[model samples]
Target: MEAAAPPRESRPGRDWDRITAIAAVLIGLAAVLVSVYTVLLQREQVRAEVWPRLDFYYAGVDGEFRVSNKGIGPAIIETVEVSIDGVPVRDWAEVTARLGLSDPGQLYSSLWGAVLSPGEHLAYLIPSGQEAFAQIRAETQRISMTVCYCSALRDCWLAAPEDDGQVEVDACPVLPPERRFQN
Candidate 1:
């Protein structure tokens, strides 16, 4: 029979092995907790960036074409450039001339503003008579516009028909800039 091997001596760090393993597990758990907390904070940041939607659209009321804002937040208008039939319009006079809106001067004369808040609207009442409105409607075609605006936070956006029915936003600081029109 072979002689039995001598009994092995206990190593100095043998007990430390269990302690090191426990420490490693605790460190891993702390790392996971940190990652989870950071994710939660990021989610809140994303939510903050996506609110207060602003938009522009047309509404017909009492035989009038109204330009209105339908957003929850106030939109500080930076510019309002409208083109009809591929021609840029500076003022209502140009719009009247280009649209051939016969005898509809009174209401159209006062249409000028760079800023529009939610639910606030500007109207261009089609001349008092139905017959006059008919002529303007037939001649109006291919209306394109670019309304550059900003939020109270200075978040800029462009409300354009060419965006496939969507709003374009940018973080660039465009505030304190000259507005294209006066209210």
Candidate 2:
């Protein structure tokens, strides 16, 4: 028989093969961990950036406090529920009835200017000074606003509270109107 080359070493050295296999497994595990971490981080960022919150100066006017939506995000004013000293105003029902429409766009168009998109924008008027109205003062009243809008991804975050008080379009801040709402 032709001299068979000494049987080639039957296999790679056990030490070297074991080390290589372990390294590969570690690398794969590390990649999976990194991917999961990245996804979680992205979700957190999205939650932080999506909504708009507005702070406004409420003053007594016409024997009532006039509260306006100073921050924007296609503010759903109809859905707004105002409270004075933790008491919910019952006049909102009358206001809604007078509005004659349930939608924000229609409500805005009926009032002034034109329909607006999600961002820092003006809102409907609330008259203060009436017993039902919150006491008008320089002290800031905590206002919680909620609304919904579409993203570039075409996904709707409907009626969701914007956590950071920021209204954004493609991740850009929508500036509040320079002229505050009066009356």
Candidate 3:
């Protein structure tokens, strides 16, 4: 060539390419961090909702036959069902009639409206001199109860004498307010 060309100089905006690339990497890192935070929060919420454990059992402590709650949560009792020889007794009236008792309340005082905490129970003590006492003493009756209860979180569960035992079910029911304290 007749003349030598001047050396080619880089554009003034050459630094802009590096700045754009850095900005993209920063945005991607931010997105990943947010995703991880969301996953951790969801895990915590699931653990809180399902951590309570409840169990129902029949045991003869001393001479008393008791239905007990051995759970960590507060059970809000909604309904109770008694079964004899696998036949379900629908109501307290039906059981009273079957037992030939004048009042069902005289039989089991704590069976209804029981708000059982851990280590709490309702006793089935056979009163002496009653004709029903003989049936109980003979152990001829296989009396068992299924309780439908809920936790403070409004999660419902069924405590039954079935082979599968207690399980989580629908939403907890809303109950009437408890009695007022006299003091």
Candidate 4:
């Protein structure tokens, strides 16, 4: 009779190989997750580098009202709304006429569709003398201005003379021709 074959021993190597494969898969998954996190962080950093902030400047002594881009990026003025006693005015002429101020022959710049670069300013309204300035400043108590602007990345903000600072907005509202400020 042939001798019984020795019982085959369990192969420990096979178990080790299975464990190693599982470990490799886990490591690969972790690497992919980290890569995704890194990419998201980089995108936020880029947005910050191009963020824009628009600031309103009112100089009673200088007789000027200006809008400036104080951030590192450019600001695209989308719409400018000038109101008196909560009523919208179509243009600077209307604002002056309503305020009962004679045209002082001052210079003014358009705000709609204008782009303001960093550190650049646009004098929206400039009175010719301190007398006009004083009158306007006094009457300005009842006046309010709203400017909606966007950055290169399409991030929008609403700035006003009354607000302490600009407020982030989802988007600027589209105004009709009659409601839009002409200057």
Clashing pairs in 3: none
Error of 1 at 153 (Å): 2.0
Off by over 4 Å in 3: 1-63, 83-93, 96-106, 124-134, 137-144, 162-164, 172-183
Q: Each candidate's root-mean-square deviation in Å? A: 8.3, 11.1, 8.6, 4.0
Q: Tell me which residue pairs clash in candidate 1.
A: none
Candidate 2 residue pairs in backbone clash: 51-162, 52-166, 53-165, 64-128, 65-128, 65-129, 72-119, 72-120, 72-121, 73-119
User: For all candidates, what are the clash counts?
Assistant: 0, 10, 0, 0
Q: All candidates' lDDT scores? A: 0.58, 0.38, 0.57, 0.86
- The digit string of per-residue lDDT tens for model 4 on 89-174 reads 99887888889888658778899899998899888888878787777878987898888999888889998877758889999989
Q: After best superposition, candidate 1 residue 165: deviation in angstroms?
A: 1.4
Q: TM per model?
A: 0.56, 0.40, 0.52, 0.85
| Superior by lDDT: candidate 1 or candidate 4 | 4
Between prediction 1 and prediction 4, the one with superior TM-score is 4
Backbone clash total for model 3 is 0
- Greater TM-score among 3 and 4 belongs to 4
lDDT of 2 at 71: 29
Counting only residues 3 or more apart in sequence or on different chains, how many pairs clash (N, Cα, C under 3 Å) in candidate 4?
0
- Model 4 regions more than 4 Å off: 1-14
Candidate 2 lDDT: 0.38
lDDT string, candidate 3, 51-102, tens digits: 3444543343333335566666666776665755666565544554555554
Best by TM-score: 4
